[model samples]
Target: MFRFLITLTGLLGALGVGVAAWSSHGLPAFVPAEQLPLALERARAASLHHMLHTLALLGVALWCRQRPGLWLNLAGTLFTLGILGFAGGIYLLRIIAGINEGPLIYVVPLGGFCLMFGWLALIVAGWQDSGAPQKHD
Candidate 1:
């Protein structure tokens, strides 16, 4: 579990950087000037989610090293799900083949919800941990 989260963090970070670079450089050439702004906007949104969730996953991995709680684990799982569903769906919807609406469209809001739930779970864990005594090593 520990190694998986760390590995996922690294992979997600790399993917985020690659996609960001592609959005900045390659996407402009492929999209028309008039439609460039919208395309770039969605790409930027997806890139932001990917990068931010990568950090969250890293934090969860590090947190698990000290103490692996259920909420913490849940947060990590949801973060992973959110990244796949949210960013993946966005890329498929906007970037690939320019298909605006598709079956994956349902996944977008669910992904966003997952991301929110992930954060909420993290917050709950933090609050619970704060109420408990800390063990200094």
Candidate 2:
């Protein structure tokens, strides 16, 4: 699980950078001129969240290596889910027209909530690990 999380973090980080580049260079070609600004804004926002949460996942992965607790695992899982739902949903909404009012609209906020809860889980992990003995190499 630790190795998987680390690999996933690296993959997500690369994907986030690629998405940011595409948003800046390629998005304008796809969106109409009138709608380009809003589309770009949304894309950039998604990329930002994508990159930030990927970093958070990296932290959780490293923490798991040291402690390997339930809360850390939950944090990593929630961070991954949040990135997918929040960032991936925004990218989908921007690229696919006429889906604004669909059920996908709920995904972004749900993802945001997942991110918030992931942080809370991290706090719990730290609290639980505080009294535990440290493992040394």
Candidate 3:
């Protein structure tokens, strides 16, 4: 699971860079001149969020490698969920105009909540480890 999370970080990081490049260079060709600014702005926002969360997820994964606890797992899960749902949804909305998404749109904030809880859970896990035996392996 830890290894998977690390691999996921690489994937997300690469994707974020690719998206950023597209936003910087490729978007102007596809989107209309009038809407170019809007498209670039949204794409930049999504890319920034995606990259930031990728780093956060990477940190959780690395921490999990040593601690291997519930909170670590939860943090990694929530970060992934938040990245996919929150930033991912924002990116999609710009592309797909009128798709019937229904309650799926709510995933953004729900995912954000999950991320916040995940970090809080990590803090709890750290507290649980206070005065405990330390093992790097």
Candidate 4:
């Protein structure tokens, strides 16, 4: 599981960087002059979330190396799903043009929710693995 997480993290991290670079340097070429601003904005937003969550995934992977738990595994899974749904949705919507009004619209928000839940899961994992039970009287 540790190796799997690390490998996934590496792949996603590279994808995030690639998307960021593409958004900044290559997106303009594909987007129309009038639509470029909105396209660029969406691309940038996707790239930002992608890169941030990829880092979070890396942290989770590293944490798993020392201590693995249900919540930690769930967090990693959610983060990976979130990146694919959120970033991938935006990229599709912006790049595909006519499909903006399609069902893909829901994917971005769903991904955002997953990302938020992943953080909550991390919090749970941290508390669970804090080492030693605390006494409150």
Candidate 5:
């Protein structure tokens, strides 16, 4: 279960990174002033990518056959909220506001920071599991 969750998260993260990279291929030609639409598109793509991570986090919490401990629970909470509040807020702002300045705009980056914390929590979970001594009867 542990391996599966970790591998799944890694794979999903890699896929998100890959799609972000691919989507960015044509971005260089645009001048800075004209990049608003492009940035919006990227943010939209990132939202979708973040959703994948969000789903993986849920799966890690719910689908794992073993019971989850504190770290997993915290990570899951952070990841879910971060994706929704951070990336979701940004996606909404871009779609609705048509630009960046607004109350909701700050939510986007805060979500990102939450996501970082979530990932860190996940690492800590793995580390804790690894540090536990194996027992045998």
Candidate 6:
């Protein structure tokens, strides 16, 4: 279980790094040579990062059976939701004007709060699991 968490975390960390690098350098290959940096930043941070983080949370959630793992996974999931709701809403509103999502943007803060609670739960679960005394038969 620990190994699984480590592996998923590593993947997320690696993805974050790759995204940072790509946003800094690789976007020009796809975008027109004339677009401003702000547009690119918005796309990379809110769009690309949102997608990557969502996938990372999903991967982590696959191992959510153990207590600590579940909390960590939940936290990751909430954070992913926050990104999708908050950043993603704005992205969609800007890029997909015809699709009326309405006041779903109001849910963004709730998602953010969930993300924070998830992290706190993860920390507490970790401490409880680690600090428990092992039983001997």
Which residue pairs in model 1 clash with each other?
Answer: none
Q: How many residue pairs clash in each candidate at the backbone level?
A: 0, 0, 0, 0, 0, 0
How far off is residue 4 in model 5, in Å?
19
lDDT: worst 10-residue window of model 6: 91-100
When summed lDDT is taken over every stretch of 10 residues in candidate 4, the lowest stretch is 128-137
In model 4, residue pairs whose N, Cα or C atoms come closer than 3 Å (at least 3 residues apart or on different chains), thus clashing, are none
Go through the candidates in order and give each one's C-alpha lDDT: 0.85, 0.86, 0.75, 0.85, 0.63, 0.54
The residue-by-residue lDDT of candidate 2 on 1-137, one tens digit each, is 78989999999999999889988999878888988888988987898899999999999988887778889989999999999888988887646453678677888888888999999999999888965545623
TM-score of each: 0.87, 0.92, 0.80, 0.89, 0.59, 0.46
Ranking by TM-score: 2, 4, 1, 3, 5, 6
- Winner on TM-score between 2 and 6 is 2
Cα deviation in Å at residue 74, candidate 2? Answer: 0.3
What is the C-alpha lDDT profile of model 5 across 1-137, one tens digit per residue? 45545655665566556545543553344326476576657565665748566575856555333555678767876776776666556545654444578675788788888888988987887777654343321
Off by over 4 Å in 2: 131-137
- Model 6, position 19, has a per-residue lDDT of 53
Candidate 4 structure quality by residue, lDDT tens digits, 13-101? 88888888888898888888888888888888898899899999999988887787789999999999999888888897646453666
For this target, which candidate reaches the highest lDDT against the unseen true structure? Answer: 2
Off by over 4 Å in 1: 130-137
Relative to the true structure, candidate 6 reaches a TM of 0.46
Candidate 3, run of 10 with poorest lDDT:
91-100
Q: Which candidate gets the maximum TM-score versus the true structure?
A: 2
Estimate, for each residue in 1-137, the C-alpha lDDT of model 6 and write its tens digit: 54554565566556556655665676666546555365466656565645555564555454354333456656665665666565555445432332335675555456556556656766665665664343321
Better by lDDT, candidate 6 or 1: 1
lDDT of 3: 0.75
| Per-residue C-alpha lDDT of model 1 across residues 1-137, encoded as one tens digit per residue | 67888999999899989989988989977788888899899999999998999899999988876767789889999999999889977877767657677675878788889999999999988877755443322
